[model samples]
Target: MTQQDVVSTGSTTEGRAPKGKALAATERIQAPVGGPGRGPMGGGMVGQKAMTFGPSARRLVAQMRPDRGKAVAVVVLGVISVALMSVGPRILGQATDLVFSGLFSRTIPAGVTQEQAVEGLRRQGDGNLADMLASMDHVVPGQGVDFDAVRNVLLVVLAIYAGAALLGWLQGFVLNTVVQNTVYRMREEVEAKINRLPLGYFDRSPRGELLSRVTNDIDNVSQTLQQTMSQLMTSLMTVVAVLAMMIWISPLLALIALVSVPISLLVTRAIMKRSQGMFVAQWRRTGRLNAHIEETFSGHSLVKVFGRQHEVEETFAEENDELYRVSFGAQFVSGLIMPSMMFVGNLNYVVIAVVGGLRVASGSLSLGEVQAFIQYTRQFTQPLTTVASMMNLLQSGVASAERVFELLDAEEEPVDAPATSAPAVRRGEVAFEDVAFRYDEDQPLIDDLSLVARPGQTVAIVGPTGAGKTTLVNLVMRFYDVDAGRITLDGVDITAMPRSALRGQIGMVLQDTWLFEGTIRDNIAYGRPDATEEQVLEAARATFVDRFVHSLPDGYDTVIDEEGSNLSAGERQLVTIARAFLTDPALLILDEATSSVDTRTELLLQHAMAALRTDRTSFVIAHRLSTIRDADLILVMEHGAIVEQGTHDQLLHAEGTYARLYNAQFAQAVA
Candidate 1:
């Protein structure tokens, strides 16, 4: 979970969305996949498991294919490093033999030759001692250890080890570079993928869970590669190099060590099989816990208002406990590997020692060779153990990679239309020709809807909640495409025009205002980024934003806090209106734009909007019937169809859906 707390940045909707559409972000309504208590952003349902292990593991490896050159460099360095280190034990063994030979020379008593003394001892019935002495090379009868020779061999061993250490460090550096660079590109791809995804994808997926995939999962992948790859390469190489040395020293000892390989593999494979699912569950639970926490903090006020804090706490405890349980299980299962491998290694050690001793007693192998062989035995078994222990990291990384891959592979919005298809000139005349749409195939929202908003006209839309008020404006913006019919601007089909070009000519102010963490001037200029100071002030005044802004200490220069918590609801709405006004769009869309402000401010905004709507086509979705009293034409929608269309007075005279809605509101106001 993230340490930084962030307020939820979403707006309010007066009505719920149609089926197949995501519920307003603020609602706890359950979708098919993510139910209530799943938290906002819709975390994965309980008992959901990760993807198959093999394919995910393969895909992760494919990600590293681009870094093959650096990987090869690491491998080459590891091989050279291991080779050099492998030679050190043998050289040290030479030093040991020299010391043993010098100590034995004094006990031999000056003789014709060392061979003659060994033969005399053998004839005197001391066969075992004679045999041991026979294994020593170049031992003069009365000479002590040659300190100078021993020092030379010891220096060679030190030099070999130092060279090996240098190469090992170099290998690690290159491997780290490869892992970091690969992860960097992976992060870039994921970020780009997020932009390409459709709005609905976000509706279904939890924000916290998606964030976990993008941030925590990718970071884990990086750490896993960094921790395991270099060591894995070096350990495997050490095993190969040390095994070769062992075989050369004594085939019998080498064979004995090989006995542990199959046993170790069986143990590793068995434990990995059992632990993989636990790791998957561990990460899944982590995402759920994060989502719960995000929802709890983002909607903290509502929780307190309804006295749901205790319930929220209980939910959090449940998810947190689940995460803990799975995490502990994964760790406990994978942790058994090192000790088990160590036990097997110890048994092999005992067998090799006994066999090597017997060979030395019979003079089949010299004592120094036996000592070097014992060291090689440790070198071989140690790398095997190291490789076995890396399984835990490997499984965890692949699990994260699967989650990230799922995001990268999500369906994206269709590509934009060609620029050549764009209209030569954009006029504010919008027509819906026999349009039909459904959020879900079985449940239609709008059907055979046809209407036209002529240039310089204000078309007021009033309806009950879920009357497709926002959906109508959303269609104009092409936030979604129609299922059967085409919408046109200036007689040019909107689908033919590039979406960007079509949307650029339109300005929208939603009921739920959005303001970023920047100065008021910046937020107002968001719709037209290159707007001049004069243009900004002009737009602000026209939207009544300047009236309150100038009263503040910094005026337009005042910076909004995160999610604009520092601004009042009306102030934030006015800022958004000014942003839309600055664009000077050919068309305008307002969804209860004046809902957040008081009556006085609403009257001022009405006048401002009236002026701005001159010579511009505007679509106004209103819940307050009183607000549309002076509108040139009023469209009363019911069940996604326009049930009444005319001036406001005509609609009331008709005594249909519009009159009932208006009278109800009037009566409620009086009450």
Candidate 2:
């Protein structure tokens, strides 16, 4: 199922075109279903297709097993409510017939006994009718009327309506609670699933798209449960009750009402067949438009700096126009359902009125029964109209549910097996033995790689872009396991150890620093959540973060905006370094950790790092040749293979790839 199948019902509202502010508000509201520019009913961008309804719907229902008793009670209440409500029109019709019968009957003198009147009719050879007439003694012709009987009928009808209303309210109340709790559980599960997913899964998926699933898709399911589920139950019950009442009143009129059903069905089927494709297009365009907006706005500054604002606007307009066109088509087509059904219903009404009038004249049917059947006919068609309108909501909801379930069912990171022994104490010694790996099997990235870092050794890796620098780091961190050979920590195979335990002993600081929206102290202590204020301050001082923190108005307690947007790039980098230092792991991985710092700060950070690396294994990846000049060992990599390995001075003297890179940087510095 495509998004086109999930058109919004709000678009069907008829009115003059919205202007100015109203137009903008409408666009925002409709952004998830339809928008400004769209294709014909059958046109829009195709998205991740929706799954078959059966499996997903069944799973969703099963998820509600915990609320099964409440759901059953709600359904039962709905049925009783509808049944009581359905009997109202028939009872009213009976009252109407009684009033008519008394109005036309022979005038009985005032104070005449009901038995006397019955005896007179009995003598006329209508003994059965006389007996029935005797019971309605107060309903005398001309001289008086049966006000008491009318009052009693009205009372009964009022009681049924009140009971139905009470039950209806109760059902809604219970259903609301069930739906809210069910959605809450689903959201919790999705959040947990996100934590269990592999990093590679995120690498291959767009962050915005994943966010759409978590927020938009799940919200759609919640809305459907809250709104559509109750309406669906009420509509179905109403249709059934209305039909039964119609038949009970008079089979002939019921048959006449039945004719409208097939006609209504045919009209609905034809319109739906044409509209479904357009609805799909509408939803698909909405998603695409939303994603484009999200992407563009997130990088708004970049677009402006690059002078590409016009291009972005043009792209947006194109998607927006497509959305409008498809939405218009889908809404227009679906709007046909109510009028057509009403037309069929009206025609059936005409037939029933004419036939029932002739029957009443022939004394075959009462005026009251015909009136009651007409009301039933109207009630029956109302549910059909409701169902028709609700189809879009139901389909959209299912589509959203399917997307959410797809994410929940996605492949997760492999779980570790039971460890044969407890993790060994580390001595800062790491080794990679003949490791081979590739992101894609057809293109090998690392081939027969072997390396070792002895205790307290510094291993600096220098390489050009696409030289597997990051991939190697990822392997060491076990973010991705090697396809062949083994990596060990202190001579023990790393794979045999649990990932959490292994990662706990390693610290990394990347070039792209990430900080959450919190105070500077909180960000510094992220790696060690339980760190004391003194420890946080020490780590901050070691990374030179304290220098800037003390200058801010609130010092360490200053609140940071999302992504640390409130701070400078260098400041963000320092916060991350502080986070790494607080952990004080046995092994450290620094990937251009000082790239964002100026010369003065870099010197201070380098001094701190040198002291921190004493008696600890450290791997530094950098493009700046001057940064690792004093390393104990330097590995020059080319095309995923190490071309040279030695101390910085030794590699510079040998004049291989490392020497050339160093000479070039040195030449540029002098120039």
Candidate 3:
């Protein structure tokens, strides 16, 4: 095929395009079974990809069991900080009262006896306590009171506040440590799950969506929780403590102080009620933006080839605008909470002063008492405002909590087998016994499928679009359980065995080969890390990967970029094939084994597959018939059922569906 004949990704050459043709035309197309790009359907299931947050986040934490101590320490620090803040105002008030008594001189008022003056001092102390406390706060000057003593008391108050502040800062530090730990642990878990999850999982979820959940969404929650533990919780404690003080000092004034609280709280609640939904939306848009970016970059080459850069940019702009709109709404509403609280607080202060002043002037209250009342009122309200502001953090934390919980609670693949025993083994053979599967329960893609690959023989599975060829391989690996039937290896059910054990002895190579960011030597030794260097090179040479590796800039030491994008598709395939060859498994499954490469690369892969399949149980799923002509058996699948089965020559002689497909493809190659 020349450049002119390079068709767009989903355009049909001769047959009808599968469903999702509309979405495919919009941007880069993903696997058919996976939903949109490679979605929940990519595994050819009706189930959406497991992209929820809660179960996933919990699992992330579970992965870092060692960090559990740090998480607990952080919470402890947070509680202590709250406790200190709650008691701070009262401690300062008590110290101020002591200084007031010491500074006024308890002797008689100029010639009165010491005993009478002591009695008078006791009387005046009540009258002076509020002013004394205010003076200690540096909010007023002491009259007939010792300035030195007041200074000493003020110093003590400062010490108390300083301790509270220190605890507050420490709480912040510990909370951040926990946040980072959670994120680190969660990220590790996501990576591990991604590695272990079946290929069908990737097929269903778009790479961008998963990336968003793992990276951005988790960050939002972590940041929110960090703030909640430090600032929000502390502020809430302070408000409660101050209110308790006011109510104790004088219930009347305390009642007046609280008049504005309900109004303020109402406004705060309304704002948050509106803001929380916006926040969730904003985060979702953030995920979509990430998904957009991933999609654009992943298919940059295709976009350039098709000259659709403008379309790409326009689509990106739309997603960006939506994100901006939602973000602005969320932040704007959350930001309003503080200023509104302050306004309501000031109003409450005015009412407290008016009511308290009348009582004081009427001699029902002492100056010190009134002053203390005012200070306590402000203290209570200040925390109320603070806690209100912190509500944003709380809502955010909860949202993240919800997301994290979703991931942590996700349906994990079963680990135990059913009570029933598997089929008795007659030979080291594998068979798909009436298997049917869908990623989701709603859609069934493969129905009543059955095939057999006898031990020491190679089998080929072939089909057109959505023919369930790859899904068959997934079942054999138990990457996914069949919805209807059971698959057996050596006549023993695959599902009955441990997945690790079942998959441990199986090797596979896919069309879009993936190589992690590592040295070429390491990539080949991935599954079998214990393999020797000699074994590594031998496998590489056997698969023809050594021919190219030696020619690279740094030979085997050269590092591959993400997904081996730096290498050509053929080179990537060669590396993956070599890795598979190194494993030397009992059963080998290759899906679209050589679909992406040129004729030369195809020939190399064909030679490599031939060597790899010798004396081993093998199954090859392919659209390219030429690569599998030598297979001992060929099974043709359609809509989840085995429609035809035979050898290459036998299928040709039978004049059935396989023969028609073979003839058509062969004629096309000749043409």
Taken over the whole model, the C-alpha lDDT of each candidate is: 0.80, 0.74, 0.67
Compared with the true structure, what per-residue lDDT tens digits does model 3 show for residues 1-671? 11111100111111222232111111222344323453211112122233233444345446446767876775566566655655555555555555544454332254554345435545776544333332332222223445676577578767767776787677678667766776677667666555544343444445666676677767876776566555655666666766776777678888888788789979987898788777667665666667667777867777788887887788779989998998888878888999999998898888888988777555465445667777777777877787787766656555555444444444445554753453454344888788777654665777776677888899898988777776677667665677778888886788787666677768877765767789989888887889999999999999998888878999999998756767888888888888888887778888776887899889988998898888788888888888888889898888767888888999989999988988898786698
Off by over 4 Å in 3: 1-35, 39-109, 112-145, 166-201, 418-428, 438-445, 668-671
RMSD of each: 4.3, 9.9, 7.6
Q: What is the model-wide C-alpha lDDT for candidate 2?
A: 0.74
**Best-to-worst TM-score order:** 1, 2, 3
Question: Model 1: per-residue lDDT, tens digit, 389-430?
Answer: 888888898888877887776656678777655556666999
| Poorest 10 consecutive residues by lDDT, candidate 3 | 1-10
Candidate topping lDDT = 1
* TM-score, predicted candidate 3 vs. hidden true structure: 0.80
In candidate 2, position 558 carries an lDDT of 98
TM-score of each: 0.91, 0.85, 0.80
lDDT of 2 by residue, 1-671 (tens): 11111110011101111111111111111222353222111112223555555676688878788999999999999999999989999998878877766763546655666677778878998765665565442355554446678789989999999999999999999999999989999999999888766545544343455677788878988998888888889989999999999888778878988988889889988887677666656655666677667767767777778888788788789989998998898778877887888888788888888987776655566667777877887788888878777766665676667767767776666686566564466687889999998765667778999999998899999988778776777777776778899998888787887777677778777776767788988877777778999999998887788888888989999999766877887787777777878888888888887877788778877876776677789999888878898888898888779999999888978988998888887896698
